[model samples]
Target chain A: MTTVAPETVPAAPERAERQRGQPRWWLYGAAGVAAALGIWAILAQMLAGGGGAIQRLASPLAVGEQLASYATDGMVADLRSSLAIFVAGWLGGGILAALVGLLLGRVTLLGRMFLPIIEAIRPVSSIAWVPLSIVWFGFGFSSKVFLVGLAVFLVVIVYAVDGCTRIPGELVRTSTMLGMSPMQRFRNLILPGTLSEVLIGFRVGLMAGWGTVIVAELVAADAGLGAHLMAVQRSYDIAAVMATMLCFAIAGFLMTVVFTWVERRLLPWRLEEQR
Target chain B: MTSKEAEALGKTTRPRTGSRHPLQRIGLPLVGVVLLIATWEVTVWLNDLDSIVMPRPMEVLRALGDLVVSGEFWDDVVVSLTEFGSGYVIGVFAGVVVGVLMAEFSVFRATVHPVVEALRFIVPFAWIPLVILWFGTSLLGKTLLVAYATFFVMVVSAAKAMQQVDPTLTKVGRMLGMSRWRLAFAVQLRAAAPTIASSARAAAAIAWIAVVAAEYVGASAGLGVLIINASTSLQTDVVIAGMVVIGLVGAGVSAVIGWLSRSYLSYV
Candidate 1:
C-alpha cells in the first residue's frame, strides 16, 4: 500500500489552475494571426504587380472569393468521399495492427522472428505502393483505400508493439502474486495499460492515412479533394488550388482537434503525466 | 559478492524464459524473410498470375541487377540523394533558428504561432500543385517542397524542446556570470540537443518522402519518375526495383541518423 501511494498527483490540479488564469493569451494569439494575414495580403498584392497576375501565387482576396464559391459548389461531396476513404483505411489498418501487435508482444519468439521482416518493409514510403495498389485494385476507391491502409499499418504496428512491450514486469508479478489468472491479468491490466499508447498510435496513423489518401487520389481518381486539386492545377486556376488546399487544412485541423478531445476524455490519467 | 547473492541477482535480471542465443536472435529473422519470399514465389507460381500484375521475385532481382548496371539508374539515385541532402540541411538550419527565436521572444512566438499552426494542417502532398506552378519541375522546386515539409516538423519539435528547458538551468548560468548569448548557446542549446536531434531524424524521413512525392508529380528524373514510367509501360519488375531502391535508401538514411544520435547526442 505504501508503495502505491500517489506522491506527485496532487500537484497537477495547481498547475491546471495556473494555466486557466491565462486569458490574455487568446488576445495575443488573435493579434498575431491578424498581423500574419495582413502581411500575407500585402505580400500577395506586391507579388502580383499590376497587369498580369502571377499564375502561380494567387492573391488572398482571389482565393477567398474562390473559397466562398466552392462552399456552394460540390465541396461537401468531395469532403465526404475523402473522409470515407481516410476513415476506412485508418480503422482497417489500426485494428489489424493492434491485434497482430498484441500477439507478437505476448510471444517473445514470434517478435524476434518476424520483427526484422516488418522493419524492412516499414521504410517503404506509402507513395511507393501506389503503383502496386493501382495495379492490384485498379483506379478506384479500393486502390486509394489500400494505399492509405498500407501507409497507416506500419506506423500503428510500430507504436502498438512498443506499447505492448513496455508493460512493467513488476505489474505482472504483483498481479500473479494476487492470484490472478493469466487471462484475467491480461484483461484487467495489459489491455487497459495499452489503451493509451494504442490511441496515440491511432492518432498518428490517422494523419498518415489522410496524407496517403490525398497522394493516392492525385495519381488516378475521378473525385475527391485531391482530384479537384489536380483539375484546378491543369487549368492553371491558382485561386481554386489555394481554396482546395485551405479545405484540406481546415478538415485536417478539425479532425485533429476532435481526436485530441476524445483522447483526453478516454485517458484522464495521462493528463497528469503529460503535464 | 557471495555466490548466493550473485545467483539471486541473476534470477532477478534474466528473462523468465531464459536469454536467447545471439545466433537465434539474428538468424530467425532472416529465416522469416526467406520464408516470406518463398511463399510469394509459390503463390504466384500456383496462381499463374501475369508478370504485368505481379512480377516473380527472380524477375524483380534481375530488374534490380539491370538497374544497377545502367547509367540512368545512377543518375536518378544521385539526383534524389542531392535533393534529400540539400533540402534536409537547409531545413534543419532554418527550423532550428526560427524555433529558437520563437522560444526566446514572446512577440515572435505569438506572431508566428498562429500561421505555423494553420499551415501545419496542410499535408506536404497538398503543396504539390502550388510547388509545380511556382518552380515548374525544377530541382529547386523539389528541394523547396522537401524543405517546406521538413521545416514545419522540425520547427514545432525544436520550439517545444526549447520551451521545455528548465528555468533553473538558466538561473544557474546567470549566477555563474555567463552572458545571455553564452548561456543560450552553452546551456539551453546543450539541454535541448537530444530532442532537436530526434526531430531532425523525423525531418530527414519526411524530406525523403517529400522528395519522392515531388518527383512523382513532375520530375524529369528520379526513382519516383522511374516507378511512374515503368508502371505506365507495364514494366512491373522495374517498378518493384525502384521501390526496393527507395526503401533501401530510406533505411540507410535512418540508420545513419540513428548512429549519429547514439554517438553524439546520448547524454540526454
Candidate 2:
C-alpha cells in the first residue's frame, strides 16, 4: 500500500490533461468502432472472396477445425516432446549463465580479460550455431536443446553480469560497515539484488529459447510444432498451418503471462511500483 | 574452512588487482580459448565421434578455405545480402510511416497497437507457411516474411520513441510561431532521433533473425538453406564453415550499421 510520490509519476500531468480533453467513453467508443470494422472486413473478405484479396486470407473456422483434428493426430505428442526438451535446455542454460556471470562479474581480472571475447561470442546468433548443434547432437532432442541453450545462454549471462556490476557501491560499503563477511554480504545483498535482474533475463531467455527451438525444429527435426507446420505446408493445408501457428502463439503468450505472474508474486516490491 | 570455501571467500577479500599489465589481460583469455578448443578436440577423439558427426576444428578450417575459393559461396552470400537489404528497406519505410501516423492519431494508436502487439507474439517462422501459400515460395514470399517480422518491431519502437519526445520541444516550437505540422515533423521527430537510431540498430538484429527463419522454411539460396543442406548430408565440417560465414556476415553488417549511425547521425 506504499504510494509513489506525485512528482515521481511522469504520466500524471498528461493523464489529467488527456482526461480534460476527452471523455473516457470516447476511447472505448473508438475502440469498439475499430474492432467492429476490422471484424466486418475480415468476415466480408472471407465470405465474399469468390476470387479476391480477402479470399487469400485463410479461413479461421477451418484452421480451428484442423487444429482439433491435429490434436487427435499425434501433434499433442510432438508438442509434449518439444516442451520437455525446452524445459531441460532452458534450465541448463540459466544455471550455466548465472554461474559464468557471477564468476566474471566478481572477478575483476576475469571481467577485463574475457569482456572482449564475450562480446565476440555475444553477437554470434544461435541460428548460426544450428549447423554445429546438428553436427554434434544429430537430429534429436540433443540437437534442439543445444541450439536453444546457445540462444538463451549469452543473453542471460549478459543480463546477470550487468546486474552484478550495477549494484550500488554504497550498499557494499554499508554491509562492510555492519561487519559482514564476504559470503554473508553476497548472500544477503548482492544475490537478492541480482535475483530480480536474473529473473528478467530468464523471462526474455524463455522467449528466445522458444524462437530458437522452432527455427531449429523447422530446419532439421522430424517432430514439434514447426515440423507439424512444415508437413501442413507440403500438403497445401494452410488451415492446419495457421492453426498450429495459433497454438504456438498462444503458448508463447501464456508462458510470458505466467512468468510475469510468478515475478509479481515473488517480487512484491515491483508490484508495489505498479500502483 | 575447506580449501574450496577458502578460495571462494578469498576472491573478494584479497588486495584488489584493479590494474594489470596489458599482456596479462590479453594472455588469460587467450589461454581460456585455447583450452576450450583443446577440450573440444579431445572429447571428440575420445568419444570416437565420426568426422561426419563432429569434425575437428582443422577440418572446419579446411572447409572454410574451400568455400572461400569457390564462387558458389559468394553467390549465396550475395543472394542472402540482396534479400536482407531489399526487405529491410521496405520494412523500415513502412514501419516509420505507420509509427508516425499512430503517434499523431490516438485512434489509430489504440486499435492498431493492440493488433500489432498481438501479432508480435507470433514467431516469424510461423509466417513461412502462410507466405508460401500466398506468394508461392518466391523471393517475394521471403521478402514479405522478412518485412512482416521486421516491420512490427520497428514500428513499435518508433511509435514508442515518438511518444517519448520531449513535450518542451513542441511547446518551444509553438512559442516560436511554428505551425503544428512543422513543429511535429521538425521538433518532435528530431528529438526522437536518438531512440530511432538505437531502435534501427535493434531492428537489424531482428531482421537477421527474420531472414534466417524465412530461408529455413523455403528458400532456393541463403545461409539458412546452406546450413540445412550441409546438416542433412552430415557434412559437419561444411556446416561449421557455414556457421562461421553467417556469424561473420551478421557481425560485419551490425558493425557497419553502428559506425554509419554514429558518424552521420551524431544528433542521434
Candidate 3:
C-alpha cells in the first residue's frame, strides 16, 4: 500500500500547478450559472405569456419578489415551527437509534435474531406510516414528530449497528490481551471507532428527517412549510408556492453545510479519501 | 502480549465455521416473524383495544385477503403500477441522457449544477402542490410527480457514476483505435453500470414514495387513495393492508432490480 503511494508522486507537481488556476475555473462556473438562470427566466416568461392555465406558472422574477417579502409576511412563524419539529424529531430518533444500535451490535446473537425483521420493516416507506400515525397520535405536533423520528430512527440504526460490528478483530484481540475489560474496551475503542460512522448515519438521517417532516406536515399539520405550500396552492398563488419551495431548498442546503462542518469538527482524525 | 500472540488468540476465539443447516437459517427468521405476530395478537387481545385504534393481527390478515380477492383492489393496483412504471421509466431515461451530457462536458455540468443542486433539496412531497396545480388530479399529474421525484436522484447518481469512470480506461480504449462514441459506450458506460443500476433501484423507491404521496393528496384510484379513504373511515385494518401491499411492491421492485444487475453485470 505504501509503495503504491510513490507511483503517483511524479504527478503531484503537475496537479498542484493545475490547482493554482482554480480561480479561473470558478469564473467559468459562475458564467455557466448565469447563462442557465437566464434560460430559465426566458422559459418562465414564455410560459407565463401563453395565458390560460399556463399563466399559473410564476415567472422567475415574481417568485423572487415573493421570496423577498416572505420574511416580513408572517411566514417566519411557520418556518420556526417546522424547524422546531424537524430538530426535535431528528435528535430524539438519532440518540435513541445510537443507543439501541450499540446494544444490539454488542450482543451479536440478538442482532442476528432481529436483523431479518428489521430489514423487512426497513423497506416500508415512512409515508406508509402516515395513516397509522394519524390514527395513533391524531393531527398534532406529536404525530408529525413521530413520523419524522421513525424515518430517522430506521436509517440511523443501520449505520450505528454497522459501525459497531465493523470494529477490527485485531483491535478487540489486542485490547483483551492488554487486560482491558469489556467496559473499558467499549469506552476506549468501540465508542471512538463508531463515532465517525455514526456521524455519517446522522448526516444522512438528518436529511431524511427533514424530508419526512415536510411530508408529515403536508399530510397533517396546523403550520409548517408544507402546510404553507398547500395553503398557497389552494389559493392559486403560484409565486408564493415557488417562494416556499425555494425556502425549503435553501434550508436543506444550509443544514447539510452545517452538519458537514460539525461532522468534520467531531471526527477530526477521519480523512476523506478521494475517489 | 505481542501482535503475533494477539493474532493467534483472535483466530482461536473467532466464531466457528459456517456449518449450520440451511433450514436453521430460514427457520430463525420465520420464528422471529411468528413471535412478532403472536405478541401483537396477544397484546391486542389482552388490552381489548378498539379495532379503530389498533386492529388485531388476524383482522389485518383477513383484510389483506379480502383486498386481494376484490376487483377494486386489483384495479387500484393496476392504476398505481401503470403510473409508477411509466413515470419511473421516463424519468430514468431522461436522467441518464442529461447525466451523460453533463459528465461529458464540463460547461454543461457547471451550468446545470447550481439549478439541480438547489432543486434537489426539495423533497418529492413538496412538489405535490405545484404538480397538482399544473397538471391537476389526472394520471398525468401523478406520473409527473413520480418522474420529477426520481429524475433528480437519478441525475445525481448517474453523473457521479460517469465521473468516477477511470480516465486510464478511456485512454486505453483510444489507444486501441476505438472511436470516441464506441469508447464511451463500451468502456465508460460499462464501468458506470453498477452504480447506475443501484441508483436506478433507489430512484424506483423514490418514485413509489412520490406516486403514493401524489395519490394521497388527490387521486381517484390507487393504494394511497385506499389508505386515505380507509383512514378517514377509521378502518385501521384496511389502511394497514394497503401499507402491506405498498411495502411488498416496493420490495419486489428492488429485488427485481438487484436480480437484473447481478445477472447483467456478472463480471462485476
lDDT of 2 by residue, A1-275 (tens): 01211111122245436745778635754685567556855874665555533235555567679888988987778788778777878888877888788778778767765655666665556776777776667778888888887777766777677668778899999999999999999999988887776776777777677777778777775888878877877887767878888878777777777777777789878656744
Relative to the real complex, the DockQ score for model 2 comes to 0.25
Give the Cα lDDT of each candidate: 0.77, 0.71, 0.76
- Clashing residue pairs, backbone N/CA/C < 3 A, model 2: none
TM-score of each: 0.91, 0.86, 0.90
Give lDDT: candidate 3, residue A241: 92
Instruction: Predict model 2's lDDT versus the native.
Output: 0.71
Flag regions of model 2 displaced more than 4 Å.
A1-56, A67-78, A271-275, B1-28, B45-48
Of the candidates numbered 1 and 2, which has the greater TM-score value?
1
Docking class of 1: acceptable
Instruction: For candidate 3, write residues B172-264 as lDDT tens digits.
Output: 999999997898788998999888887777777767877887888778898889899899899999999999999898778777877887899
Candidate 3 Cα misplacement greater than 4 A, ranges: A1-22, A49-55, B1-19
- Summed backbone clashes in each candidate are 0, 0, 0
Lowest lDDT 10-mer window, candidate 3 chain B? Answer: B1-10
Alpha-carbon RMSD to native, per candidate? 7.7, 7.1, 7.2
Rank all candidate structures by their TM-score, best first, as comma-separated numbers.
1, 3, 2
